[model samples]
Target chain A: MTRAAPNPARRIREDIEGRIHSGEWKPGTRIPIEQELAARYGCARATVSKALAELVAAGLVERRRKAGSFVAHPPVHSAVMTVPDLAELIAARGESYRWEARAILRRKNAGGADTLQIDGIHFAADEPFALENRTIELAEVPAAAEANFAAEAPGTWLLAHIPWTSARHVVRAVAATRAEAAALATGSGAACLQLERDTWRGDRPVTHVRQLFRGDRFDLVAEFQAGTGKREGN
Target chain B: MTRAAPNPARRIREDIEGRIHSGEWKPGTRIPIEQELAARYGCARATVSKALAELVAAGLVERRRKAGSFVAHPPVHSAVMTVPDLAELIAARGESYRWEARAILRRKNAGGADTLQIDGIHFAADEPFALENRTIELAEVPAAAEANFAAEAPGTWLLAHIPWTSARHVVRAVAATRAEAAALATGSGAACLQLERDTWRGDRPVTHVRQLFRGDRFDLVAEFQAGTGKREGN
Candidate 1:
């Protein structure tokens, strides 16, 4: 065979990914044998094997020792998540909203939020607001967080970003600190609500969020279609 | 004209999306004008206009006044995401999945640990014997939190049966509160690290995630590919 040059692994991986992306290989469908991939990519069997390994690392395909490498699923959602102007979320529901950025600190990588958002951005911390948190009216959205949420809460504001979307939320029990817990309201071991949400508009994720609802107040409500057969899009 | 119960707007949108996903409409290609789409879809200009607007809302297309609608940049990744079993995650890497159920709350979705989870299995806030919050070690899948992570991080276990091929991630900054700040080892006014991930294998959105990191000891890394623009699956 007039062989292709080096970077065989890259070529094979790309080829496999392209096939899956193009729907030539559907999720759960097995890939060609290592022997077959080698023949097609014009590389040694080991190189083809390595390419499959790379796909595994990328979480694009699965390898079953005897069953062979198979496509993971199908076209997964491609989320274009954005920080919605808070006011827009609330106002969309015909509700009014407000905000306040408490104790703003432009920190490089601050901790305290949920794990999903940690690798995402460097935030400007809070200030001038009691409890060192931002509040919102659930009605207005300027370019960014604005006003003091004396009357409105940030959680309420942020959650309104999407209408009739699907979410997987988590509420947990945690020990609260003196200042921070007091700020968001609740008590130590009082078990504040740690609400994490992966909000989706169809399959496109609108936002992934983790919030602490005051343990003292606030409740979680989730209503499923039970058996809608197949869920519909928003 | 013999029309087939024309939904010109709908057809136009599907055609554009098909072209984009099928690699016919390359990225950054300026889409045709409303008049052009009208001609192609055999519909009035307004019909084509509506279709494009809908695409924009769906995050699959973008328009720039006179610039016209073009396919928005697809997410860099095309991984199928799934809500996987934490044990499966680690075991897949040749490890063990272990955890202790701290508590299971049953409620109408209000207050404390019962406040966040809403799927109605109630929630078992678990303490992972081996837990990975923001970072899932490749050697060890760690724990993926699906809902009430305080008791049981869902990533530690799989609730649904789906295969994933790709993963999408987003990060951002948020202010910390007393309770959450204390748990994450940050100050009330400090910035926190957040990570949101959506994973896929093929076309299905198998899993959607939002993870918060202990900002004090977290880092986000990026591995870029050469400029070979591709297409989005979902």
Candidate 2:
């Protein structure tokens, strides 16, 4: 069997990126129409459009339905986010991990903050485990999550059910509150790792969760690739 | 003024996604070719190709240049990652954040474990600060980094110059060594927050950095959107 020809669309994307990086196509400059780009590249208009779409997704250009596409001004500051598997994490360290669903409630509070105010251990396995308090506003909880939470734990169910477009995470150390201490069987006011996460589907908010880990019990790990300066868009 | 017509490619994408969700198109099932899909959609073949490309990028389907596209088999586990700005964090807490470079050096070792060892504090702001010990393998350091390390800290310089496509971060609690204690002015063996991060540009590794935050000084925050089961692709 013969090998397929290289994708011209990818090449077109690189060419356009080269021009932008070289300052030949400055930021805020309007790019040629898809039809014109097609003619220049000797490729189909759809190929040019596909190439342009990638740039748009990468935050390099802005496309108006009629006004056409223009290079985007650089953003002030930017960051990226990722989520991990708790079971795999524990197993990796040769520890047995177990998750139990204690209770699921449908709460209606515009305040969007529901602290897990418990006076006893949430889950007491052979070893100590952390209590992850997930507080999501009703408005932010999606329909699928509503259905899934009835059957599975929030974190496990959400990961399988939703394909999130973007997310943000913040972690800080806080003195364990009375509730956290009772649940983890630890001393009050001990320094613990508190992770707060909120996720979205495009512009639609999904859920906001706060997980408190026994400082001695858990850790979070993440890995990524850096965009080469020339092709770095978003 | 007349509004531009809706993008046909996007409509084609939604249509294809609907079929997949409805089980008309099952996993590992080969999708129709661009020509056939275009004819069915009553649009240009390029439009169908563009639509298919989106599915391919979103991890819904796999496309072979010579063959066609097929729905992807389910993955075992998935994880997402993000990077946060430290300065913005300190400022948000109303504490002034300052970064001072104490030393930069070049060493060759395949072992890839080099802590930011020092006899004095690296950055002594008015308020207490976290001492991040980042270690990168020499092979992973890019040319830009080799030049930048001579002047500034790795994390500070890399964020401004390099664009990473992906990264992995691992957060764990560990006993601070004598060196870390001296730098942060904390007691040795204190349970500090240790963050290990490795970033890549596509398949090529960029840097592996380990940062130790004075447990009391910092926290991490993350937010994300779940992929709706229908379009749920990695």
Candidate 3:
């Protein structure tokens, strides 16, 4: 069989995506319609349709029955928790990383929906930039409490001292709470990214953490692998 | 190197968790305060403290200063993806799985703020029962359309038919829209789980999809190998 060059639809999708990504075509801005695009690109309408379909699936554009194809904006929040320290997470992206702790002490979260048995030193940091609340089992994972955050986040501190076996994460996009807004230095009603996680090692539940991230500043990603006989053994 | 059984904090966290998981303490139901629980459990306030802290992290409870801790009643959602097929996911825990396509059609999507290309087949099953909207790259993945949906979802179908080199995912929570509420078989204002993804074989983006799941019914989970060198390979 004669192998062909890349398909036309992919080329178009990429060409258009590149423009959008390059900000030549901004969100909410309509590009050429299918008919116009078909004429200009010298492809059949079906080809343009195919290319558009892939972009839609990838969540790059919005379409209506006859509204015409246009560019889609980036997700307000693209959150990925790949298990890196705060400094590393920010720094890995080539963005400058900075952090500070306001206060440090052993404290109790006495009220909420449940009584948390937190025993780690508590501290506050620059707004949503890197505000985090963390806990480590002093007994089951006694190494947690021994983490010396120093100028680092307790979250980073714990990661260095203890080795967690497993973790459960509960994440969401919620309007900021009054107190949370104040603590994170964002005004109330502003959109914020909330992450609530519970981690375990083997059969023992280890630590739980709740973190709030500025929506514009973060992205979360979870890569998928073929779960066939060759399941990537995480 | 002496490994012993878990300490008192683990025991207490487990005890309380068992109660919650066992329905001893239902959602929104008030539980004893720290002082009360500390005395009742016959452990030090510190031990009770540790236990509850773990629960908060696990998202089983909520804590408010001075107000006391109560079970965090809002239904906790888990990120459940990467398994390739929903049947395998449901059956992993030993449950009978059934899937039927309620709607499937080729449509055009105008670019939204999230992305720019929108042209593909949209598939939705029985609401939280199931929903998948993906782009079939006609230009690149010719077999996308005209594939089988009789026995599996589009995700499972394509995985079985083609071999793409790479994929990317964006998972987040979306509040139900009037249309989503009707389509998902849920009430308006309910939380809906949304995942936006882009996949590439290498440099070429091959596929894109956005899936909305019934929030009351699903959770997302991923296992990580600690110290896998550094997290976030990208």
State each model's CA lDDT, in order: 0.45, 0.57, 0.55
User: Residue by residue across B30-123, what tens digits does model 1's lDDT show?
Assistant: 8988887777767678667767766764556778987677767642221112222434434554544444343433333222222222121111
Model 3: share of true interface contacts reproduced: 0.16
**Candidate 3 residue lDDT tens string, B1-234:** 222335767767777766665456766667689888766766678668767765764556778898888866633122323334444455555555545555555554342212223322233332244455666555555555656565666655554444333456665655667777676676664555566777654455556777766666665554432211111210
- DockQ (model 3, Cα): 0.08
* Candidate 3: tens digits of C-alpha lDDT, residues A1-234: 322335777778878876665546766779789988877777788779867876765556778878777666433212233444555566555665444444445544333222223322222232246456666555555554544555565555555444233455665665556876676676664445556677665465667777666555555666543211111111
Docking class of 1: incorrect
Model 3 C-alpha RMSD to native: 21.5
Better of 1 and 2 by DockQ: 2
Model 1: fraction of the reference interface contacts it also forms:
0.01
lDDT of 2 by residue, A208-230 (tens): 66767777766654433222222
Worst 10 residues of 1 chain B by lDDT: B115-124
Ranking by DockQ: 2, 3, 1
Question: Of the candidates shown, which would achieve the greatest DockQ relative to the real structure?
Answer: 2
Enumerate the candidates' DockQ scores in order: 0.04, 0.28, 0.08
After superposition, the stretches of candidate 1 with alpha carbons farther than 4 Å from their true spots are A1-87, A104-174, A193-211, A215-234, B1-60, B63-82, B90-95, B98-234
